[model samples]
Target: MSTPLKPLPAWADVALIPLINVAAAFVISGFVVLAIGENPLEAVQILITGALGDLEGIGFTLYYATSFIFTGLAVAICFHAGLFNIGVEGQAYIAGLGAALAALYLGFLPGYSLVFVAIVAAALFGAAFAFIPGYLQAKRDSHIVITTIMFNYIASAIMGYLLVNVLRVPGQMNPETPGFPWNGRVPQFHEVLAKIGVHWPVTPFNLSFLLALLAALAVWLVIWRTRLGYEIRTVGANPTAAIYGGISPARITIVTTLLSGALAGGMAVNVILGEEHRLILEYTAGFGFVGIAVALMGRAHPVGIILAAILFGMLYQGGAELAFEKPKISRDMIVVIQGLVVLFAGALEHMFRKPVATLLARRTTQPPI
Candidate 1:
């Protein structure tokens, strides 16, 4: 009789795999630093000092982390369901524009209720934008990567035209909509913290950081505790097997895509509601694209995504400073670092998987008949 196959390791049990990937990324980053003739230790110190050197720096780090949290989680959700979503950029753009329009025109409501409405509208628009691609994929078997990338271009052009024509403020020469009303903005928590002699970061970090933490927790619960999540995972693991077992892969795919888009939409709360309090041409600034790298490095785990998000946030905040302080180091160095992290993580998975399976098989096999 053939021996039964052992189950694959739980994510928690294989925790070292991600750790190894992160460690390898750092080593690779160090090499890049050396190749550029910079002392890796000094570069690291600068990065750390710039990210957390002072209260202001810490505040900035948190600000950046907030956006990272949203996009990273967006990417993570689809990845968990074995879907590759590359449309976060477009989704974010549309969502931000939607929020901006709501805040500008809908803020006339008598109470603070408009704030919640704006957020919901943004999320809904993002979901709708994503649903189109999801439906096409489910119905026609279209490749998600190609469709999503095309959607990104379509979103950018559409948003651009709207901003230049329909959404343009009466007097503003710039390609942007009117600033959001006071009620629509995320309150400045830093000012309150300052009264106690504690300064919050002026960057994207703020109440959104807490929101990101809560989102991560919620995602973890959904994935590990819910029947829907089980179905998603089942389909991800093997669609034919899941179909035979009564799970609907198409439904799961569409649901997963919608959820991913909603997360991307939530990112606008930080941009249009928190920081800029308005929608601008460069509002997304590529955070959506960065989410892909974050998700890959995190391996699509909620907690892992949070940690990876913070790391990317730090790189973004610190890299800006590095460019300003040491003009010799290009801001593009951050991109290089991020790319290396993704590469190391992807490569490490293959490196470890074969060895791990071989060892496990040896351990489980019967030695003698």
Candidate 2:
């Protein structure tokens, strides 16, 4: 009698799944473009050209990509630790307020460097806002998803009230805080580059791009090379197993969630400090939700997250242009594409697993001649 062989693990084929999903997404998006009576090839050409055809386009893509990187990393970290941090949006909003206040109130501190104070203030605010949900989850054993969602609503209402009343800039009807001083603004280099015919490829792309790259690298290093990362992974994989191995899953959860919030908070600096230099109502603009998709698409890997972020950023910038150039094609079409991509990607994990397992089982159980 022959012994039964074990099947290969599903994760062994994880690499191919994302690729297949991406290809399918593109095909579906093409169909969508056709359904709207637009030439798929022309639509794709417009997208590529708008995203990367010139220096300005490239800059905008990179600028958006930088913000996505920060938020995406935040989502990725929480996901890796088996926690869902839906509070990134609210945390980022509160952090922006803190940054604006710091710039307005703390701007007069003699000898205090602008960059140092703004960054510290934003990070602290972000950490504090995020820590609330983390504490609740740890102490009360509450569901993070519910707590975070509640916090989002609370933060939005609070921010709206503050922007309209307390933080409102004098003489401006807009519900926004006063713009940051010269010291708080991120330096613009594209103008100088353009004068020399260099045209830096985008208006918004700047040093923040490098900062995002470093952040992604740091996340990868922390998750793959450090002891704390091991604890996080172990805890995520199995709380019971992690507890048996002497790791405190509760502590890991708090730490990971805090780190995730901090990352999201950092995105405010990129926006308020780097580009906008003001706390506007629409400052975050759904980046948090988009980050969730990015995290899922990347499978929680930092490099993959970066790639996914860039792709989404490109789509966002390009889709806007597509709408403008082709009045018949709505920008919402891009949203449909993104939705399809995420839906397929989500299903792919399970779709690939069942078939591969059945095939491996059949292969292992087959009789020999």
lDDT of each: 0.80, 0.80
Q: Over the stretch 58-143, how does candidate 1's per-residue lDDT look in tens digits? A: 77877777787888888888887788899999998899977887889887776757777888878888888998888888888998
Which parts of model 1 have CA positions greater than 4 angstroms off?
1-15, 194-198, 352-369
lDDT of 2: 0.80
Please report how far candidate 1 places residue 309 from its true position, in Å. 0.2
CA-only RMSD, every prediction: 3.9, 3.8
Q: TM-scores across all candidates? A: 0.89, 0.89
Candidate with the greatest TM-score versus the true structure: 1
- lDDT of candidate 2 at residue 247, scale 0 to 100: 94
Q: Candidate 1, overall lDDT?
A: 0.80
Instruction: Give the worst 10-residue stretch by lDDT in candidate 2.
Output: 5-14
